[model samples]
Target: MPYAPKHPCTYPGCATLVDAGNGRCERHRIQERRELDRQRGSPAARGYGSRWRKARREFLRQSPLCAQCYVLGILRAATVVDHVIPHKGDSKLFWNQSNWQSLCKRCHDKKTVQDGRWK
Candidate 1:
């Protein structure tokens, strides 16, 4: 018997019906997979930018103790300023000091990954 499917493609406006097991029609599924690949392959998604590097050094010199680490009982010494909300599309977010926080490399990376800070 031919297999029926479930969970049609989640692409923005795609209307092609999906399969019972995979959740998407063949074409829509391929498109979705490609999009996922692109997202994963993006430069920004890989890590910080040149601007972030510059800002990080200056921030670290100004404040060396990781704030969140202290709060979390980690006591990590080295720290970097991380934007609470990324400044990617909104350059105005770059200079908003209030939106910045000091965090250890480990905590910063974990927070960004767990909560998708740069993503």
Candidate 2:
């Protein structure tokens, strides 16, 4: 175990070295996790429990391509099951399959910013 690989933090412009398997350095990891928590709240609180997970799996199986990427002429696989319209705790809206869209991480992040979801 004498030779370990090193890489830059996933955070933008961060020079901290982290293990290859890790996404970010300790400090930036904490900061990013805190920000993500504040934005998304708890998964349970956001109605994303076991039931949601099951639905998500089924949805992804049905729509395996990123909708946004497809619209942009790219054929990326979908990794996130996103609500086309934010549910915002509305049960009816939350359960609507028609409102669901498959998105890759990149498209999902862009959509989150555009939807003002991270503010």
Local distance difference test, candidate 2: 0.91
Clashing pairs in 1: 4-20, 5-19, 5-20, 6-19, 6-20
Please report, in order, the local distance difference test score of every candidate based on alpha carbons: 0.72, 0.91
Highest TM-score scorer: 2
Candidate 1: tens digits of C-alpha lDDT, residues 1-119: 96664564666677766665555567876776678878767645544577777877887888778988787776777666878887765667877778888887888888888876443
Assess candidate 1 and give its lDDT.
0.72
TM-score of 2: 0.67
User: Could you estimate the TM-score for every candidate?
Assistant: 0.50, 0.67
lDDT of 2 by residue, 1-119 (tens): 68678989988999889998888899987898798889878887789999999999999999999998898899999999999999889999999999999999999999999999754
Q: By summed lDDT, which 10 consecutive residues of candidate 1 come out lowest? A: 39-48
